[model samples]
Target: MLIDALQCGNFDREVFEELKAGGFTCVTPTLGFWEGTLESLDELGRWRDREREYPDLIKIVRKAEDIRAAEREGKVGVLLGYQNTNLLEDRIAYVELFADLGVRVLQLTYNNQNELGGSCYEEHDSGLARFGREVVREMNRTGIVIDCSHVGDKTTLDVIEYSQKPVAITHANADSLFPHKRNKTDPVLKALSQTGGVIGCAAYRNITPADACATVDAWCEMVARTVEIAGIDHVGLGTDYSHKTGPNHLDWMRKGRWTRGVQYGAGSAAVPGKVAKPDWLVNIGALNSVEGGLRRVGFDEGDIAKIMGGNWLRLYEDVFG
Candidate 1:
């Protein structure tokens, strides 16, 4: 019952088949990032059609039971998620509206500041704003998971303190390991673990070490360190896999019309155009390597199970009511 907590790849039949073949029980697909309310809804509608188009391969998951049902039937459950709350804008009610639309996971901010809070790339973080706090309250009430992956340090801490329910730093790594802006600090990780929240370790090359060091072993070592800091129940796989995507998508992800000039995020400046993914964790199919890596690093079966997908399921059961 492997569950990938995050993957925003090119959504198609081939991708679905690959996930199905990889033994994925469920996955959270990012439906919103730079999109507004209407655009996000359009994306959601497309996903609805996809569910209809590939009924045998994919099913919509609004709760833990939906995930279990998909697993039982040998299909992958798709949990609708957002990488940014730009769609919510100033309207806090949109949280509930989108929650009703099956938006189970939402990241407060992307790489830049918005109505919610400052991004990780922002020079000065204002922490959680008044409107952001209100949105958090509504999300807590509506059962939408709070995500702070691309949020700034101060904002991440603020979210941990402000959220009534446990929050998630869904697809990120430990900054103490690689020291990237997208990675969370030790204090933030500790606080999240203390609150029973989970941090899904990402496989994006930018957040990890350079080149040869970005092997499955290195990632497992990072995970082991995370468990030492954040505890086993607070760690899992988010992967952040974005395979089969074109270069234009990368440009849009970084700039997103917010800047007239291109904003080279993380390792993009050196690579110029392409977004690099680690070879060992390239896509959902490579998830087995993660399990193997965990085993090599001496994580007992019980603890490895939690880090693989069980931890996220526990979180969903507690929060996705």
Candidate 2:
């Protein structure tokens, strides 16, 4: 499983041990989000210190090669990433600095408009701003993978066409399957695939629209449709699981303007309760984790390999090299 991060506050040695026991070879962890200049640097410093302290259980991985090496060495590769550009603020040079610190993936925005682009929750969806374009260009130039999962539709399409290298929708779903702002339409999937980019299907229940509750079967059906529309080569997996977080975390996620009222649809009053929810809804089922998800979906060995890590690995090599 490619996790988001292993910070001291969010996760600790116990969690890393559990991940190792669960057979997670690597994770693209978030390093910066909603942080200011000094705070961002401090976060980096904290991670650096943790890296030194937990050399045996975890290691910072900067390139695709490092992932393979970690798998072979029986250590979890911690690939750094950022979910928002807030940390970058107005300075573009910070892109290179974060890349040097092992941040390979960066989403252009979070939930609202920033210097880079408008977010999916933004009211007008004004698309990428002037600075947004520069941010994409700078990321490409610095060999960092650009992500557009939380970005607005227009902004996502614009970046896909504008980027010199293939960009990824690191965690999203097909809007046709589930019509949420966070989900992409069929056309977007086609366009992303055409650019050699990969779309990571998120395991969040709210992403699937069939019913209020989601199950593994529902998730597999969604994945099947996405593969049919985008092709198997452009598909990948991103669980987006915050497993250890408490109920307060869910409240926090929903309190945001963009995320307000956006339940995973399981048991949601919006949909009829009779329809079986997507397997991901309960958080304890076949789709609970990456390995179990593939098994339940009946994906062959080759397809499982690609979705689990190969597709992302290929993209990283192309952009981060």
Candidate 3:
């Protein structure tokens, strides 16, 4: 079974049908990124309507059993998640409220610093703030999976040290391979694995070499090397697939009312705009190509299965049980 640990796709009935037909067992579709309480809750309601509209095609997953059941019934499970803590909005108690609302996965910060903690794009990482530590504790107690993908380096380390439950870098690549700000370093990767956390290697183009065009083989090689460093049990796919989007969406993702100017996320001044995606990894169905690429790269069936989705399943069981 294939599970996408993180996806920010422009979901619709057609997308849901495509995922079901493509044999995806589960996916954590990002519901909030820099969204406030009302906006976030509104998004959740929309997801609920979708489930009602296509009951046979998709269902909201609140537990590991839900994913297994979806797989058994040939339906796709949707795990609602947030890419930032904006919804929490300075209230630690809101953690329980969102957790009760089926928000199982959440990142502490996005690409810039917030009240909770520092971000990867910051000139200096202040590490976890006093409030950030409290947020981590609340998240652990509430069973919300912590994601440090776009968090600053020092903050990421602090979270790995603070959270009692294993956290996840759910949608980032290895810095050793790409050296991008969003990528985690070898030490951070090793430490995350040591804590029994999972790292979902992303297929976002900016996370690969700037000179090289994105390809299935390149993605597979990165995953293989990640397994070699972080172990087979700690690697999975989080593709970070953002399909059916355009420049306006990119502007919102990077600026998000935080700034009036364009931030050009994953883009540069030379080629500033929508970052190109690998054609083979554009959507959930592309997992077939990823599986093929892994097989061609010498991964045994068992290891391939783990990287494909087993590791994420185990993580869900442990964190969201």
Candidate 4:
């Protein structure tokens, strides 16, 4: 039972093939980040066609039970998610509109500040704004899981405290371990676990480090340490996989329409490419390595199962079921 909390790859037929090869049972593929309402709708529309094109390979997951059914049926459960709430714009009712359209998860911010709040990369950390608070409530009311992987610490906590449902840092690592701005801080990890929120540790190089994931032993060591901080039930695989694509895709993802110049995310002026991935677990299909790594790290089978996908199922049950 392998499940990715989130993945933002240039998904295509080959990618879906790899997901099946990787033994992925379910995944929350990022559908939008900088896209506006029309673009978002078009993206969703593209998926509607894809579902018809590859009916056997995937199933659009509208509920938690759908994920379980996907596993039993040998199909990849597709949970539509977005990295930003840009499509919602200023309207709270759009929250339910998106949920009705099969969007099961939404992040408050991407890598830039918006009406909801600040992003980790932004200059100021605007702890949830008035509109942001309402967005949280509407997301709760609509049953969309709130994500904070790229959100600032303060805003992340703000949503967690104010939300009736548990929020998530869907694809990040432990900051105390890796010290990246995109990673969650120890305090945030503690608070997240306390409130039953889960943090799926990414296998991305910038956040988890390629060397740290060089082997099952090393990878499990990282997972063990994260579990030590966030608890077994709150740690899962988010894997943040970015399948290599055309050169311009990075520019669109990092800069969007907000910047005239390139904005390197988790990278800098010297190295302006996507972070390197370790060879062992490059795609979703290699996720079995994580289950092996956890066992090597002395995690009991039950705890290992929790880390693999059980925890996320429980979370989705609470918000999307």
Over 4 Å off, model 2: 1-9, 209-214, 247-298
Estimate the overall C-alpha local distance difference test score of candidate 2: 0.72
Writing each residue's lDDT as its tens digit, candidate 2 over 1-321 gives 343222212657776676666667777666655666677778778777878888888887887788878888878888777778877868989988878876778889876678787788778888888998998999999988898988888899999999999889888888888888888888888989999899888765556554423455656666767888998788887656554655554444434334546543222457422333244544322333545556676778787677767778888888987
Cα lDDT tens digits, model 1, 1-321, are: 788888885789999999999989889988867999999999999999999999989999999999999999999999899999988868988999999999899999999988778899999998999999999999999999999999999998999999989999889988888798889999999999999899998887777666423688877888898899899899998888886888788878878877888677765567667656787765668787788889998999999989888989888887885
Residue-level lDDT of model 4, residues 138-193, one tens digit each, is 98888899999999999998988999998888899998889889998999999999
**Model 2: how far residue 217 lies from native, Å:** 4.0
Question: Residue-wise lDDT of candidate 3 within 1-321, one digit each (tens)?
Answer: 898889885898888888887789999988878889999999989998988998989979999999999999889989889999999879988999999999999999998898878999999999999999999999888888999999998999999999898889999888888887889999999999999899998877777654223578767887899998899999998888886888677778888987887677766787678776776655667676788889988999999999989999998888888
Instruction: lDDT winner between 1 and 2, please give it.
Output: 1
Native-referenced Cα lDDT, model 4: 0.88
Clashing pairs in 1: none
Clashes of each: 0, 15, 0, 1
lDDT for 93 in candidate 1 is: 83
Q: Which candidate is the best by TM-score?
A: 4
Better by TM-score, candidate 2 or 1: 1
Candidate 4 ranges beyond 4 A from true positions: none
